[model samples]
Target: MAATARSTTPEDITSPVRELVIPDPSSSVRWHEHDWPHPLARWHYHPEVEVHLIRESSGTVMAGDWAGPFGPGHLSLMGSFLPHNWISHRDDSAVVRNRDAVLQFDQERFFAAAGTLPELEALRPLLEAAARGIEFTGRTAVQGAAAMEAVNGTFGLRRLATVAELLAVLAESPESERRYLDSRGGTYRLDASEAEVFNRALGYITEHLEGRMLVPEVAEAVGLSRDAFSRLFAKATGVGFNRTVTRMRLTEACRLLRGTDLPVSDICYRVGFTNLSNFNRHFRATTGTTPSRYRRIDQL
Candidate 1:
């Protein structure tokens, strides 16, 4: 029998459809909250598996050949390489600053941890099921959100505990109404060479944040063309190629502004900006405040 078409509108996605991975620090698991109009707000994919919670708004999720409606407390777990996106119809598309709480982790590492600890051993089934993508509802949605929030406020070893606790809660719930989102079978994985090339490019970006940071230079270093590099970078980092460089520069500037006595103008050039006004404008757009105010606020 033919499958019924998924219900979705045209506004739910973007074109030239590229995939991406979430840029993560070298950690076992990571949690963060981002509202829409943010960098991760795009149609993309990453290697690490993801657990997503919709904290606000009503929307539709386009998950690889499937589309469905969602609202606050909507929860889902997607395996590696499964392309997905969420589009909201709230306020005629105004921005929501804290619309989602997300937890992402390396599947290999998480299962490795699960293998070592008997407590986590039970997660094997759920983890395997997640490879096809799982959506949680009913009681599981509430519990999962609570668990994600716990990790959000925590740091150090305790955060891992919260994540584990979350897994247990999710795994035990019979009424979670867990459903697979990917109508297609399992997803794809980056090959060894792709992983290496992606990592190398990431390293290059990190090390060369100061000056003359161009996408083509990094692409040439990684043996990819400009267009290929741009698409792959957007897929891996969920941002444009040039915007990634700008972000790296301004991030360094933000750190210097808060942690050091360096004058803002001097720090601008240090982080690759040629002019002060441009620096101020980018900083405000990224951090929601000017450099001078950020410095003073951090000092207080």
Candidate 2:
């Protein structure tokens, strides 16, 4: 595979907005079954809303500011331009064949349909909620998994029904788990100039994901003083600089536990944690499950 474009600078390289050209231009819907080492594996977003399911394996799911562990049966809806990615840690290759079942559709087309269909009127609230990114849970998630799978193999109107049913199931999600991922970032997109600074910072952080990262280092890399950069980044991304790095590292740690047979200690160090207890604590706080339990449950 070729690179993420060495022609661009680290800041330019880090812009997560993906310009998507759907496989079927005539159809509003597009389906993609990607293997890891997949060309689109990095953190990126598109204007089209995405319905995503992890068909096989387990890993970290990053949708906007929300970072969490996900296994098979994991289902999520991402609004237009919401930055997200899934990283699976299977081996040296970090490979998982047929890992995702994804369908992306135009938001404009969806609203156009909703305007004429009363049944789709309920879709308005659900679609609006998608702006901040949403995850389906409980019965909704189980049904969503089945619905997306049904969508994977069908065509014509049957395919349309599966997608509709999937959305309907998610629309009925229980209030507790059908919550938004975050309040900031989904609709409040940065302008081009502001994004350039952040894009560079993102590239710098991910490049050093396995090492101790300093705020000053990133500030210098992006050509700003520490204080100014700190304030700007917090304002721009709605999270502290250090927190972003930790989230990135821990997210990768979740992938390691689920996709590989590595021991907890080794996985901890590999993901930039020098201490086992700290890794365990952070894992529990972020994922609601220990590393061992996370791996075991996913396998079962």
Candidate 3:
């Protein structure tokens, strides 16, 4: 499937599509609250570089081609325009919250601070490569998570020190330990028109994932023909309409399997899978493990 088109509106185009805006990037690192009552399944991006630490939640993490299950101890660095989201599958009553410490500064600020500083200048390539996405798997996450937490709480000079420390730690870490996502390409940004359409479609899909989600329905919602919408959606999201919907449903199913005590059949129906056999097949295909096995592993 092709990816969705870029946004074209001024507000949607100029500003990042985030729920909370962090206006100050020069002072202290900004912390945002992402505690939605229900699971979030929307595909969105921002202009800032994101450092996320998964504390006590599990979900499907989508970042370009890197789509899979992620649980506690997972940390990632997402550059501007790289779309991502954590779709929680836990029951609505269960608290599925994410603790994020984000720093949003442009290339200009980075260069202005580090260009003349010999120590920081050496890490420029690592920062540039992070424009794609970076996932830390081992000790880097442990160290980075602490730094993120400290920066979130500190202020003034201490906060700046923490932020600098976080970047330096991430930059100096061995490349072999950092898992890069979508490193082979340049960064991508959406125009106003495309961003609006894509966000609307994504919102609709998240709300109606438990029901029949047809291509025509999505196209009509976006004021396009089925064929035209299909091409555009594929182009924008890098996945076809059917595939995207299926992935969304499977993501929800994984959440339920890990965070809820619901039975397999119940989970299938809850996530919009009417056919039990088909659900089993697709779930295994997408996750590379059966629902029962996934649940067991997560429990362990």
In order, candidate lDDTs are 0.68, 0.73, 0.67
User: Cα deviation in Å at residue 79, candidate 1?
Assistant: 1.0
243-288, model 2: which lDDT tens digit per residue? 7777877877766665567788987887788799998999898778
Model 2, residue pairs in steric clash:
11-200
lDDT of 1: 0.68
Model 2 TM: 0.74
Tell me how candidate 2 scores on lDDT: 0.73
lDDT tens string, model 1, 1-300?
A: 221112222232223233444554645787888887455654556777788888886545645544455667888887777766675544434777799888887777766775667666787777777766788988888888888888877766787678888888777867438877665545534454564566466546545656678878999988999999887766544445776567656756655665568888888988788899998998898778989998899789
Q: What is the C-alpha RMSD of each candidate to the true structure, in Å?
A: 17.2, 5.5, 6.8
Q: Is candidate 1 or candidate 2 better by TM-score?
A: 2
Total backbone clashes of candidate 2, pairs 3 or more residues apart or in separate chains: 1
lDDT leaderboard ranking? 2, 1, 3
Tell me the spans in candidate 2 whose CA falls farther than 4 Å from its real position.
Answer: 1-16, 23-26, 188-210, 218-236, 252-300
Clashing pairs in 1: 19-235, 20-45, 20-235, 21-46, 21-235
Lowest lDDT sum, 10 consecutive residues, model 2, at 1-10
